[model samples]
Target chain A: SQQGEEDPQALSIQEGENATMNCSYKTSINNLQWYRQNSGRGLVHLILIRSNEREKHSGRLRVTLDTSKKSSSLLITASRAADTASYFCATAAATDSWGKLQFGAGTQVVVTP
Target chain B: EPEVTQTPSHQVTQMGQEVILRCVPISNHLYFYWYRQILGQKVEFLVSFYNNEISEKSEIFDDQFSVERPDGSNFTLKIRSTKLEDSAMYFCASKWETQYFGPGTRLLVL
Candidate 1:
């Protein structure tokens, strides 16, 4: 079963606009990671936030994790048409024996030029 | 930077036939995994391997599926008897904490 659920299954925004996607999970996690997929191709790891962290940034991407609410959000500032793709959040459960990931139903973001 | 690689970008096979999708993970990565995604669906985890053995698998991975890290680099997934329902994109990944994915092999069981 999927432990995380992402909101707004699809989103459309202008190239320079900011895109925000949210994910909520049910269990305690060792870490939460976000990935991007272009079309039907492979996934590209974007960022990972550990349970002890609250926020982190990489380039134009900013991610926030609120353990108390069991929710996380990804914000892509100044989006580009090339940023159009599917975004997924995978939770690494604290209790998972192996480094298994439970992925969320992704958010499809379309950045228009 | 090194990345995972998969061969035979696309494959077609008849039902009940055997098919092996191959992948070569990063040179130094210790953990390996196989995942699949049906058209227009979320990527699903199939199995995870470490130390040349399966560490975990999902319900979707049943008797028909098997994984092996035959050498230090190659990781393969074999479907003993293919089913039409098994048609999907199979992706191989490797990592210790952060996973890197290959372009994936699209398998179509006719």
Candidate 2:
């Protein structure tokens, strides 16, 4: 399977703290994306990091990709209670032009105020 | 911002029945996809559509499943015969560069 595996199945953190999660995949990928899903809601695209790039940042979210290791990490700095959700890493295969995303079992995050 | 849209946010169906889930992708976006997540599980890719045809599909997209872009704007997934295992949150996504997903349709097959 091309699925990615996420570390730390769940995390509970206080507001204003940082929350970091890691993802590892077994296949070659063109890019990796992070998404947030609220309980029983739609997935919201958070950020995307191309395999050629090492790190990228958007707002309070930072994403890093290491193709050699086939791994990626997402860091939410100064997390807020509203930032509580499941974080998933999805990868677009290097060979698929259509960009089908293989998702990982997500990390459920809870931020307490 | 443009986003994908799906109809019938929730559906409860009996086993062996056929159900069609609908999605309207963001206009001007050419790629469309269907994915599903069972309760407490990771999301699984179902099928991908591009240029009015299937671009790629996962093994999970078997004979029981079919996808169509009937009009220029709507993409649909038809399950020939629903099974209890088909209960999941079905999500539709579209992309020009980065994919944007629709509010999913929660399906419960009894």
Candidate 3:
């Protein structure tokens, strides 16, 4: 079974709108990271938030982690068409050695002009 | 900024044949990993290597699968006698702490 699952399997938003996606995980984690993938391409690392951190920001991207709820959310402010892609949330659990990551099903975001 | 690179952006092979996917990780990175994603499915971890040996592998990585760092820069994944189910985008990742992924090699096993 997959350790993480993302909500809103698909999302569509207009340029300049904010797009938000949520992810839930099954176990305690060392950290959670978000990645973006354009169609038929490899994943691009976006941001990572440690278990102890509640929120983090990088440019227009913001990520929040709520360990108590076993959930995390990624928010893209002022979205652009270039942001259209699949977003995945991966978890690095405390019990996992070698820092292996377990990924979620992912959310597909389509930003339109 | 340096990034991981993968060779043979696409490969098509018969079901019973063997296929090798190659990757060149960032020069200074110490850890290497392979992941795969079936169409419409989430990315799945296949294996992780460090210190020139496999450190961990998922159930999906079975006897048919093997990984090797033949030289200082190249990491390769070989599938012996590939099955139809092996068709997917294979991604190679490297990390010191945070992982950086290569563009991926799409394998189509017919």
Candidate 4:
């Protein structure tokens, strides 16, 4: 089965700094998505990058996809205290039409004020 | 912007008892999905529904678990017999090109 594994399980940084996390998957995917979950709360959709796309950006969030390496990275620039959350990378397989997402363990990000 | 909604923000049930979790996906979305996250664990996919039928389910969705879309607006997940391990935060998602998730229901099987 295809699985996404994120590196640096936990990260802590001061506000205004940049935080980057990497995710590596096992199989081909149609698109990769990034989601944020506040402590014990629901997930919020952040961004989605397609397999054909190399990079994309949304406000302060920047995402890069390298299908060749079966990996992706998410960069949060100028992080704020409110950005403290668990960041997850989920993948939608190329063959799955139902749009099932395989989620990674996630990177726990703590943005200190 | 429309968002998915779930009922019973929190539920506490005894082991072996049955419990049903309800969700109302985005009004115009065609595909729906259910996922759960154990405390401090990764979120896992449970099942996906489309056109009023289950399109895909993960191994975690066993015979004891079932889903229904009885009314046009509501989608539900029923656990016939809950176990201690069944405790988790259940989330519902509606898909367009991208998926929008609900606030989630926290189920505690004690």
| lDDT of the candidates, in the order given | 0.92, 0.95, 0.95, 0.95
Ranking by DockQ: 4, 2, 3, 1
Off by over 4 Å in 4: none
Tens-digit lDDT track of model 2 for A1-113: 68788988999999999999999999999899999999999999999898899999999999999999999999999999999999999999998999999999999999999
Pairs in clash, predicted candidate 1: none
Residues B1-110, model 1: lDDT tens digits: 89999998999999999999999999988889999999888788899998888999999999999998887889999999999999999999998778888999999999
Q: What is the lDDT of residue A96 in candidate 2?
A: 90
The candidate scoring highest on DockQ is 4
Q: What fraction of the native interface does candidate 3 get right in terms of contacts?
A: 0.89
- Using DockQ as the measure, name the better of candidate 2 and candidate 4: 4
Candidate 4, residues B27-99: lDDT per residue as tens digits? 8899999999999999999999999899999999999999999989999999999999999999999998788
Regions of candidate 3 where Cα sits further than 4 Å from its true position: none
Off by over 4 Å in 1: none
Cα shift from native, residue B106, model 1 (Å): 0.9
Tens digits of per-residue lDDT for model 4, A21-49: 99999988999999999999999999999
Q: In candidate 4, which residue pairs get closer than 3 Å at backbone N, Cα or C atoms, i.e. clash?
A: none
lDDT of 1 by residue, A9-112 (tens): 99999999999999999989999999999998888999999999999999999999999999999999999999999999999899876778888889999999
Candidate 2 docks at the CAPRI level of: high
The model with the greatest lDDT is 4
